[model samples]
Target: MSFKNLLLLCSIIWLGVSCKSEKEDPGPSGPGVPASFGFNSLKVNGAYSGFKYNDVNLKPKVRFTFSAPINNATVANGVTFQSASGEKIAFTSVQEGGDSSVVITPSADLKYLTSYSVTATKALKSKAGGMLLNEVKVELITALDATDKFPVISDEALLTLVQRQTFKYFWDFAHPVSGLARERDSSGDVVTSGGSGFGIMTIPIAIERKFITRAQGLERMQKIVSFLKKAQTFHGAFPHWLNGATGVVVPFSDKDNGADLVETSFLVQGLLTVRQYFNEGNAAETALRADINAIWEAVEWDWFRKNNENVLYWHWSPNFGWDMNHQIRGWNECLVTYALAASSPTHSIDKTVYDNGWAGNSTFRNGNEYYGTTLPLGEPLGGPLFFSHYSFLGLNPTGLTDRFANYFTQNKAHTLINYNYCKANPQQYYGYSDQCWGLTASDIPNGYNANSPSNDKGVITPTAALSAFPYTPTESMKALKFFYYKLGDKLWGEYGFRDAFSLDQLWFADTYLAIDQGPIVVMIENYRSGLPWKLCMSSPEVKTGLKKLGFTSPAL
Candidate 1:
């Protein structure tokens, strides 16, 4: 019981007390440690942001990783999901995320285009008994799937959905470097001038539909105009193709490295439409409008007149100088080239170019009768419907006429001829009926062709029919239903319809082209509300050019 014994006993008791306190009252991990018991990362359907479920057959899986190892009880009780309406969503299982994460698999396929909310509650605890510093909530939206039960959508609703989804190809999937439309899904860095033109016309549509805000659309427009300013040009015209990233000329062929007049005209058409659209006096909009106008005025349309000859050539390569040797004739998609050239204020063409060159020296007239319909200004069967579509996309066909024919009737007759030709089905293609009939320049089993009854290769380009919606709605609607509801499995994708489908070859395009997809959205909007035509025609230059060309419109 001496002083040594007392001191030793006291030391042992104090040491025991300190050790117990250390074990029982573990404080915060440290200042450097993250405060939340929630995940450092979270992925819904395998994407962190803008996750989309394209395949209707697949269920959605959400995976998350925590800052610290989470408790098993927290995993069981803390994670929950509700739809935008607060209705609970059942999950098949909550599994471990291997080391420090968790996975939740939905019990059923998520509804298309539906928004869902996922919540990790404050009850979620770390392995060390620390509660979640803040509850983690994620909002995700499911994309519209083709397999979803068909709701009774109005015709307008159907058209809007088709237009918006197709527009996404130009917006969401645009070229990473230049923000221009890619030539096709497979053409990695290649961008098309004509197709990009068609895409430009859809930007205003996107703004009107609220797919993007005016600021977002203007930002993209500025990028495009800025790129065009620095991009390669031949004779003040853009090439048929350009490298999307570096703004270099992408030779479409060995000799096609220079100015492409027809393609440039298409691009100018879109630029004018954009100029008309962003008319507000805001700094961003004013800058965009000025850039577009500068690009438009720079094109020397008269230079393409070929030594002031009657005919205008399609290409003028710096490497080969018109060696492609193609003429800008009518009864084809190049009508826009002539119209825009004649419309150009700075570099204008005389009406004689339209008359002798485009009208084939007054022989461009198509007096041929097919399927009891007469086309006034194109080859047999109106040369595959696009003759009616491409030019009229911005130029309102209603009340539009020259000396030869009324454009509206010409287009309608062309569509009916194409439709009737398919109904006749002389070639006995695998799928040609009232519900599926359109032949134009599109991919076939062999390759691309300008398909028509006379040139029937059994390929059906949906754009040939879809773009004709402005001309023939009833027939186009039939084709639309067949293409969407019946053939959605094969033809539809994350974007809307693929470029073309051939039943005879049992072939379907697994790709999309900017040219084909662009027309669908712009032309459909034109049919519904005349938005593009209104915007394009609003330009004073367009009015003057149309007058010079002897064109008249009731809308004017």
Candidate 2:
């Protein structure tokens, strides 16, 4: 008690003295005073770090700067710098100083007129190896402003459209087929030769690429080249589909039993014609031309001559009898169109035969009498039949500007008038037609009723025959501004475009794809640039087919 009381009184007196005095009162000396270890200083770098645009192109760079250098301490290993949005905007080059700094190179294109922040951190280690530090933040902006008149369909969007369609759906991280595999009816799912329909969806994407969004109309010329280079194939053909479980071609179409050069030819035509948009005599153009030529050569067109039909057969179904006489107009048009479009002064002689002879037969105008056999006994596949599948007519008479324009306008008007029946109401069919210029119609027949054949029911895909054709800018633009823009996310999907739009039904409830979009793209560019006309002039098939169909240069 006596010692404790004395010690307590001394402590109290020492505390009072220490508090009042300026000089330190060192209680008991410690060996080499331990350094103060705690979150004493907070530091950060204020710099905007993100991708910048040179005009519309991405300008890659790492941008970072520090507010002040760190002193008397080292940073922790796992400490990270991030943006306000919690994104890791780290610097590849980090240096500690009274002014600590880091530099980070962005992998993506930056938005114009935008700023970003950089952040840093410092950690003080205790003798126990535990850590203590405060996080820091900083920021800076790019120098370039967001005012560049770039192409409406920029590279970024193009890459995005292609990649998403191919990767997310077509190949499904597997491989794309090269040759023909399956035969698709107008309304069925476009499956592969092996009957494997589980692959990432390919039909809608193909349609949209060719038809709805023809903005980069000719840029797609390189797509086939890229596709061929990337496609995994057997015997010059592609698997019609990827098996969901096996990731291989499942053989879903009539052509699935064997290589289908006919479909390949159609695709090749699109690629070749579109290539003309690029500066001529360039490596890309030359390479594309060469690849397409090789592909055409590899195809055994003789394989198509079935049972001495003289015309190409639809497909070689392993299970069913080959799809013989059901010759689809759209497919036939592509084969002839692309072949003719690729004709050149150097190769015109061989290709021109298609233009001047049987292909030019006038019976085709009647839409009957192919190979001395009548078409499937149906009401002449009406207004929206062939036109709904491919915009071939749009690309056909491109050589004659006035005639082509007239045809295009008529075709577009017909599509507008037929699909969207509001323009032709009972009370206002004629006088009110002008009011519904941009509205597309439901696929329902003219006098559609619930009890009609299943195929007669109405269904409009957002990315249907209409949306993907970006060739007629004035018309497409008017339609886009009026229809697409107005529809917004309702009809438009996250992908580049959808299949069709439903005016009477739920917006995008049910949709299927056909080979619609691709031609739209080629046709738009062909008309806009007048390249298809030149190419057709170079081809015998086109001349022959045009003549056989009674189509003239002026195409009345």
Candidate 3:
């Protein structure tokens, strides 16, 4: 047979397609050779054997084909899989047809990034009760193949692997001009304030994980801060976007051209943590803190209050002031807006602005129960899962409590509600399961939309569940495995897990969003080391803000 055809045949055999090569033709034996006595191995021999197969699946299916019908009783004694380390692997052998090839599947995940061999001994007998004349083996190595598979690693190792890869979005692909994260993989010069804010939080995570040297991360931070210093602002508040190349306004909408207090607040959330993080006595750290302070203190949080009314506005344009007129409402992803506005050392807002403006809305409080989990705040089913992620990335909800809700309780309940709903899967989506869920804003087959229980689309956003690592470790880890080991070929890529995927529609988004990607790195770090939380919370101003808002932090 041609080498190409031989390789194709080997692949078919591995997939459990029954085969009897033309060379061995089970139909009849040579004049002197018995059809049931001599047989070649199902796996491709020498050419592919000397070099370890890099595409071997961790949970491999090995097939053993024969020239003639096999003696079922002797199959078990004849076929075995063994690790190079002398470990005997357990597997189940199946023969779909009485005389077909035997397909062996390991009972558990194999040690990835390592070599192993599958062997069929000569003791095996055929239907004619004659011993097989040759022994056959297949050698392989389990290597990561993002196109269709992933490696199996320890939970801690997986967490580290995930954190490091996610950091690549904020690092390798960050906008060249501003050194800030792009809105998405496709976004070029249009840089987002909110997404950049989330990206800032990942700097420390990358540093702590050793993905980048501290000096390298510090250099990036310097570039980010320098760009922000020159970026256009209205009343000291940054717009929702800035042209990365010129530090000019890139209006989110025609009316949203000037100041975006909510986005600025999100930006400040990361700034404060960074200000707290690089507290070493080094001159560079000292200068970074000073630059961060200049940006932080300059934001007129109270200016967004629109003549000091007790609530914060979302946007204000020099061209169309307050035309957007969106309020920074809560029980949403804007809690950090209020938290940082209240925390600002120079342009701080009164707590009443938070209470009357953010929590004052009718939808601000939801004591309702969904999927047996009572939500302290938010729309039924807890709105899109990001409501718990964005703000809390730096807010540290572990022991944070306020009049409206116990921040930790609220966030965890929100995650669980989202989790249980996906588990119940009343929508009956193709891939909904306990280990495969996470709904939030992402690219859908039709376009982008906020996915939640209320708006149950048959889509799963990896960041939703994976970012909830701190709130729902067990549940999140299960989803992590499902993404990494099962759907990894389609979901994981250059920037870690891609934006979103829909199995029923056979649609997988090959994009990454800064807001979504940042949380995966920061939250996973928070889950493992509490680095971001501890750094953000260490700021005296953050503690002051939480306290003024009538919240008590046991950790504080």
Candidate 4:
């Protein structure tokens, strides 16, 4: 029991504590300490979870972040990607990111919907000459292959899948703050009024298909209704865009900072549909019905008539009232505005407004022939396919007729004319086949334009054909097969189909818009079961409005 014995015992205890601390710490204790040299994190295609890349033609990349600065020379030899079959993938280059990360780019485009693995070998060394303790690997799965042979599917199943997936844009990827649909994929924090209306119409479809639970759907509907109750409004009409978080008006254009009658009509269409769907006896359902009713009743539709004029104006800004004085007219997508105006219980418009303003002061009639098919309404070649789609979404077109024309025949003719126009290939666009023809207002490589034969730009919007399913099921089925089976990887995405594509320009969009995505679901549901149309028509207000407008339908 000497002093030397005590000092030796103390030294042994200190060594034991030091070793335990070093072993427990996952990270390096100091710069010179030997540490695990492999990646602390790995990102395949920039995500930990498997992601469906939008562009099938683009090569996939792998990135790794190491615990310590990696040796520059070891990166090329230590990192590699291989297919599931164990074949090595050729890399075009390996580039360093700062001192701690490396990115591997593939030599060619990765196969679509295929699984691949990225590996970092133990040979990967830190700048301090320490080798990785173990090899690390991760998996990445590409999205569906568009060029694969077509698979057999029932028409009913295909339509249901399309509707459900499109509904996800509004339900799953809704704006975080407002619980509303975004104006488009790239539009941050900007929620759309009309597009959200289209989205709202699809909620029942989602619930019926079990894409979402009824409770989930109702919760989201509550969020949307609450936001609407607090959001800025002009004469009870919402603007085209709003800040998703604040519910404040987001100016669509320089002067379009106030009421939008057409957009409001679109919103009300969905709201009324929701009101019809949730008219149950449950307390939550009752509350939802009342909220929707309040929103529907508050819209001052008569105020948009511009001081008792026989026309309803499209927009009215508080800062510049009536400066952007575009009138709502027909043979276009604004027919719903007139119908809703007449249908409004609290603020209804007279039938004369429909006769004068919507019918283009009696110049709305257009009976024309294109490609051996007679278009019963609108200008030549039917003036884009959306005219048939937007209004007819909730307003059942089957056996729907007015003094103007038989809507079913008119819409069918319009879709057929658009299809035949592409089949004829008058412009000789690259991919204009019977199964690949739909021209509408959508994004183009140069910019956005409404595509038609008369105003023909080669941009083909998938929503155009898909939304026309009710009017032209046989032709629409052909287009659906082409879009889903042939061009799916390029055209479709997580939520649904991208905004538009141009085969002539060899361009494809990697975005989705609320306006385009909403109709695909609501109209497809309409085509499949006539659910949305039937529900909207069930409303007493809608029946009264149609009767006042002198319109007749089988449902009516």
The segments of candidate 3 whose C-alpha lies over 4 angstroms from its true place after superposition are 1-148
Per-residue lDDT for 300-413 in model 2, tens only?
444444453434444555445564344423312333432332332222223233333324434333333222333321223223333332434224532322211233433444
Q: Is candidate 1 or candidate 2 better by lDDT?
A: 1
Q: Sort the candidates on lDDT, descending order.
A: 3, 4, 1, 2
Deviation from truth (RMSD, Å), model 4: 18.2
Q: Score candidate 4 by lDDT.
A: 0.82
* Steric clashes per prediction: 0, 79, 0, 0
- Given candidate 2, what's the lDDT at residue 227? 48
After superposition, which runs of candidate 1 have C-alpha atoms over 4 Å from their true positions? 1-152
Which model is ahead, 1 or 2, in terms of TM-score?
1
Query: What C-alpha RMSD separates each model from the true structure?
Result: 21.4, 22.8, 12.6, 18.2
lDDT of 1 by residue, 453-538 (tens): 77888788888889989888999998988788767777888789998987655568888889889989999998888999999889
Clashes of 1: 0
lDDT tens digits, residues 398-489, model 4?
88889888988988998899999989977655568898889998988868888887888788999999999888888889999988888875
Give the Cα lDDT of each candidate: 0.80, 0.36, 0.82, 0.82
Scored against the true structure, residue 360 in model 2 reaches a CA lDDT of 40
What value of lDDT does candidate 1 attain over all alpha carbons? Answer: 0.80
